[model samples]
Target: MNARGFTEEQEEFAAAVRQFAAKECGTREQRAVLTDDNREQHHDSIYAKIAASGYLGVSIPEEYGGSGGGILEQVILFEELWRGMVPVHGAGTSHTVAGVYKRYASEQQKKDVLGAICAGEVMSISISEPGAGSDAAAISCKAVRDGDVYRINGQKTWCSDAQFASKILLVARTGRGHRPHDGLTMFEIPTSTPGLDIRPIRTMGGGAEVNDLFFTDVEVPVTAVVGEEGGAWRQVMAGLNGERIVCAAQGLGMAQRSFDDLLGYLREREQFGAPIGSFQAVRHRVADLAIEIEASRALTYDTARRVAANEGAPEELVRATSMAKVKVTETAKRVALEGVQLMGGYGYTLEFDMERHLRLAIPATIYAGTNEIQRDIISSTFGLRPGRS
Candidate 1:
């Protein structure tokens, strides 16, 4: 850990978050409900408690009714939140998007979204269009201005939590031609606006949490513009740095929890009168997992430092962030796989948490830019010669 990077105050914040996760987050049964399944039991009180605990808006500025904490505090909070498997504030997607708005949004825009975000009332971010998944610059959604309102027409898929989100942070084209990177813009459009429709897309793990949103002439006020009219590509690109960092943090937390579980299992399970931890392969696996996790943690925490310092996270850090996400997620997946393999039939059963971890880990490699995409990014950043070319 970077000792100088963490002050006494940050240490105390991390401790409190860990304690809260231990106490308030769901147990085995509750986790099954809060995580894998989509039960409509809106535990608003749980989020409220998180807010009252001064953690809901850890990274939002104090002027916006937050704790005025930095990215490190947020990393700590998320590490604790996901480590305990608690459903954190703003339904996942919104919290990440809100963090973007907090940093880049105009003063007024920040005030509009930050408070609702802290309260967990809104949840949305729609970068994935029907034809533009990894090719974010190829988005075809359009926002046409008329008087004081902009009429939106498009379809967004794989939008997490759009069904219940109060607002949708939409990106649409405001210009023309094949310059995929230019003339795009973003808007904070309320989900309840007329002509807006949301349908639940059943996912393997999260159940009603991800949705497909259809907009037909959805209207948003002029003030909804997040940045310059035709400057969304830059704005969206800037926000991705923070998004990758947060994703890395979440993956790290999951990896840590899986490692802890495996450690405990190895220490207790005996095979032929010797603990499993005594086996050479098991001992080596544990040691390797710990080392990989620590390396991922170092990269994630360093990215957070760059974000807080307002020093634009380097492309290398972006690559490192993706690398950490892929590495940590892969580590968790491997741990879960070996966990089941070692535990035999017990791993396949829902009575254990390893299966759920497996489900979650598979998606981490696919979302926030797939692991394949991350590899391409790293190669391009280093200007490595292409074999075919």
Candidate 2:
């Protein structure tokens, strides 16, 4: 009966998350303090609050220190958090790493890693390299097995939250297979390991959320491997479904925030003796944006439910998740831009947060695989293939 058809339990959980975000993370000033300097103290303080609320382990197994909920719970939680303007830096990456570990990590690894994640420790994944962004399998970082250990070397770009992460889930080239996607292996390595260096990447949106990582012969034990050696492609593909869904949720949350802010501004800011929202053209524009937002929410929620139910074959899940990702992100970008335009001069100022949302939305379409790549995946699902002219 909720707009998106949330169950009673889900609605109650969302209410709790909304309360938490309002009390603990509501203001831009509060978020600024929490994410400043990319320091561990701020990250820990905020995430500890979240973990205490039992959100950090949603969708993970109870035996592994999680709440044993389904993925839809996570989608709901993230949507609420972002809608409240909470910065989801560390928790987002941690949840992603938790998903990978849930399926592939050894029992002991789960006890250690998943437990730490639930306790609010940040974990990052390094996949994209300088030469490989969209082409993930084209990464050249090498992880050569030497006896019982693997020596890792090379660099990774856009590795978000590495500065605060306790460990990094690294993907590296182990050997060549018949296809480029083969021979990639995943390893969990301590961020403090010798020869591993992390440098922050500053952005216009204003946060130390991303980093460039350089590994100079860093070594990890064979036990560090998450799944079968040389089988990371399959593992990564499986994990991407979760990634896309989460990204879609993030976009939807941001879009909702943008729309809410614009509506508030329109209602109060009068022009020519009447509220600007009373204008016909403005009202029509708002109506169109509202329609798009609802459409995006429906698609995202439906896809999330399918993911939770394991309702389809892997390929079908890929298509559904990709569609969600593409639609929600594009909708977010449009909403954020329109929000800025609606707010006029105030929108362009740092005093208002709409500009920040715009900056964040711009990158959403690019990261988590560009919308162009997502379109290709959707086409392939319909038996269409790329071809030469």
Candidate 3:
């Protein structure tokens, strides 16, 4: 079903994506893919095909070789893609990161990166250092300018999909002070650059999607700087705002999918000669899940509208994003957990997608800033300064 209030064009796009997912992509055995390079190769090849089909750059401007659609279209695409299990869901994170380059890159830089990204060349943002995490400004990765190049030295952890990324949107400190946010700069660092090392970090999810990125004397030309020197703090903030909204879209999609699965199980599974869905407890829980999903969708779409229209996001936008992420992702986790519970032994088995949805939801609270940090962002907005009156 189309999102409430979606335009006809958006509905048509959703239909198109659903049709593509079902007919072309087929069902995904994502667990098997995680263990084998061949599966990843096949996955990337599929992404390249999608990129060629012109849907990969859905909301990017036409000038940048994108469809120039708004974020509402993007939201619909995410929902449909997740519903379809089309295998390119995580790749959109790279495309979203490319927005920083599109907005802040010089014309030549934009031409170079945006073109490659539109063609499905993978790039990832490297902002989370071991010491940084949610307090991103506290990143200690240092970049020292030397003539035409900036030499970088430090380690970045939790670099998603680094094993496959072609380039990294690297954030480093160019100036020194105790102020964490000051004197930061962003550069497009090719992953193959000398002195850059990437090693996969194993996790419960089994995807090896996160990595440790080490840079020692890695150098990028001055031309690689995305925006003005030392202006990266604000630039990254803007990109992050957009990132949170995009993440909320993903979270909403996963939640919806899990809820749908749960509903199906409840309708079909028999308990005491009656469908589980006939139970008051099960029905009430399902209704609550539906309500929460709809609420999350509304907030996410509203935030997308503000971003796409170039309007200043309300101060609450951050908290709103945080709320959406926290609620929707946690909701996804709940739905997945209870889905597994309600489905009995089958839910815990590898044969089901509910477990994978649970794995995916676990990381959502950690990425794009953790839920605890999100609460801080929300609390900081209330102006709790003492004696201000």
Best by TM-score: 2
Identify the superior model by lDDT, candidate 1 or candidate 2.
2
TM-score of each: 0.91, 0.96, 0.91
lDDT by residue for model 2 (1-389), tens: 67669889999998998898888777767766776622222356767888877798887889878899888998998888878876667878888898899888889999999999887889999899999998987999999999999999999999988998999999999999999898999999999899999999877657667889999999899999998899998888888889999999889999999999899889999999999999999999999999999999999999999988889887899999999999999999999999999889998887777888898888889887899999999999999989979
Candidate 1, 350: how far from true, in Å?
A: 0.6
C-alpha RMSD between model 1 and the true structure: 2.7
Residue 37 in model 3: shift from native, Å?
Answer: 12
Q: Which residue segments of model 2 deviate by more than 4 Å?
A: 1-3, 35-42
Candidate 2 CA-lDDT value: 0.88
Model 3 quality (TM-score): 0.91
Report every candidate's CA lDDT: 0.75, 0.88, 0.76
* lDDT for each residue of candidate 3 in 154-265, tens digit (9 for 90 to 100): 9999888778888888888899555668888888888889999999887766456778999999988998888988888888877666677767777887888888878877
- Give me the runs in candidate 3 sitting further than 4 Å from their true place: 1-3, 24-42, 310-314, 385-389
